[model samples]
Target: MKHFLSINSCSSQELLELLELSIDLKKLYKSNKRVLCLAGKSLAMIFEKPSLRTRMSFQVAMTNLGGASVYVKPEDVGGIGKREPLKDMARILSGYVDGIMVRTFAHETATGLAEYASVPVINALTDWSHPCQAMADIMTAKEHFGKIEGLKFAFIGDGNNVARSLAFGCAKLGMRIEIASPAGYELDKGSIERANAIKPGTVVQSSDPIQAVKDADLIYTDTWVSMGQEEEKAKRINDFQGFQVNMDMLKAAASHVRVMHCLPAYRGYEITDEVCECENSIIFLEAENRLHFQRALLKKLMSSN
Candidate 1:
């Protein structure tokens, strides 16, 4: 729990504890109770990749907790490790801010910041993983179903960062996760093996989207063309033709199956416009949980107690 780098970095108990804390914080907020656990604390947010949710959620989470956040773009710090080493920036920021949150392209960048910072460092988003998003997603599922364990979660899209992080989170939380992707876009063997090690038989991989969602309680998807993959947009669309989560795919899933997507969704692409607005979609709730989950995370990581 020292740093929120990856879901695998946390034990099962820690993950459960975070979920509990997130629920408690969410309740307090909804009840109009003022939470000032991080009073006088400051967070430094570094963005190597542009984000709407990640940026707003962390900043607003800190504000909600009676704290402040400073947004640092690439040019603001001379490009994280360009003019100065990551260690230097980490050490320097630690002196000023109680915590650091970074949304970057390389996974190593986050780890590098944590390596030198005296304060806690959170991985807002990395090319290899999106731990916060996965945690919030689990929270959303728990809220919807009143529980999470033993649920069948199917991820039908690119086996990208979101899929990998969900696999790790689900394995730790006793949920079965099946990831479906095209041949070249499948989750890496090492990640699948690592997730399975946490809870044997928890992670399953498939090439058939329809078969993957069979009997699934939750079906998830993400954009096929991510930030750096824009050049491959046309090719990705062609490769992921049959992978879109439409009404037909939902029909194949369990009757109570709910849909989720990390936002900035491309309608008629990875998911259909109808599906995005459908009764089964909890995408907006999933997005809102990001604020709640990060508030709990900030309290956990920054509180002196």
Candidate 2:
């Protein structure tokens, strides 16, 4: 069995195939294709942290494909490696569910689940990466722009999980990405190095958002602080003060620029309502793609040999 815990798990061909499948499924949906495609398959999702988008999107994707979900909140799932060992739980759950997904604090946790489980383990989120979100973002790019490579994408704001995944994935598909973040809030150095190793000249990280945005076709931004970083919210807000993506920043990019956000945004903080509501704002479309992307991913990972 194969798993999709990270973008690196599959070759460039497999990645492209998944994107093509998303496109096909989307066209089918537009033609009123109904009923779940993966009716009998089940995905056991375990979230150590709470979420709105990940949970809802995955559940809906499963239901839309003729499948069902069994959500295991942190407590319900033994709080992850507490009530029993991770491997033990993995051994047990793999037998019951067709696949497993865990949104935990460490990226290693997802890897551990995949290591122990006999079934595929998807990474809904791990502190270090968001492979699924990257899929949707890329799918949107393919749907709108018709290609991923050679397009310049500037990610302005916090360089967190989404940034890491996007950096790796864009590199895999031959896209040039610039990450502009505050000095202390920059993307993981490891992710940058890994992306460079995957494809030379694929990723560049810096602290200058405006410079990164210049000549870029796509402008992407995320929240100043992540879900678990609430304790440092005040500090992050001050640190990311000039990093906000408003109209001024959008106009700094190319005339054909399109805006994207993973959503659950802060109205006037990292992004202003004016920008998210703009004609170029494809943020909602990106959000909606989360479901289609997951459907395609589930279809691939759950497919039996």
Candidate 3:
């Protein structure tokens, strides 16, 4: 656990331990208990993509832990890996910060940073995976359902970063995940194979949203148009026509099914306003859990003990 790069990089025990820590932190936070585990630490956050949750969650998590964060944009550093080598930047930043967190377009940038830096590097989000978001998501599901293993999880949308990470998380935790996506938007073969390798028969893919949600314990979705894909917005909207998670999709799922969405949700697009505000939706709770999970993660990565 040197670097929180991807869910696939973590063992089941590590994932569960982080979740347990997150739960404990959440309880302490609600009770107004002061947690200063990383009191003297500093985190450096580098961003190549625009963000809301990723930026706020890591910054607030550091604040809650009695630590501080420094936000770095591409222009601030003369463009990451363009003006200077990634290894050189990684080494320089590691000398100043206790940890590094990056939200970038290429997955290699995060991994490359981890390779050269002595401090832990966390993948805030990449075009390929969103491990932190998945951690918070699983925490929300566990808090709601009382457990995660053996749960039937269904993901309906582009088989993008969120869906990929969720599949890996569910597979590692012994939950079965089914992803429903339109043709050409399905989860990549390598990702599916890796997830199934973690837990045999853990990931199932399909084209029909209704079939994927059948008797599912949790239904998840993300925006069809992700950051950097603005050019394809119109085509994505048309291609994902029947893929929206609405009342009709919920009606097909189990009676106890809960809904989750990684935020910055597009109302009337990936999900409807009705479903976003429904009783079954834990979207807001899921968002809040991001802070808790990242707090636990920072403490684990930066604390002396």
Per-model TM values vs. the true structure: 0.99, 0.96, 0.99
- What's the lDDT for all of these models? 0.94, 0.87, 0.93
Candidate 1 similarity to native, TM-score: 0.99
Identify the candidate with maximal lDDT: 1
* Tens-digit lDDT string for candidate 2 (213-297): 9978899998887878999999999999889999999888887889999878998999999999999899999999998898888
Clashes of each: 0, 5, 0
lDDT of 3 by residue, 1-305 (tens): 89999999999999999999999999999999968888879999999997888889899999999999999988998888999999999999999999999999999999999999999999999999999999999999999999998988899999999989999998999898899999999999999999998788999999999999987999999998988899999999999999999999899888899999998999999899999999999999999999999999998888976
Tens-digit lDDT track for model 1 on 144-194?
A: 999999998899889999989999998899999999999899999999999
lDDT comparison, 2 vs 3, better candidate:
3
Error of 3 at 192 (Å): 0.6
Distance from true position, residue 39, model 2, in Å?
A: 2.6
Q: TM-score of the candidate numbered 3?
A: 0.99
Cα shift from native, residue 168, model 3 (Å): 0.9
Question: Model 2 RMSD to the real structure?
Answer: 1.4
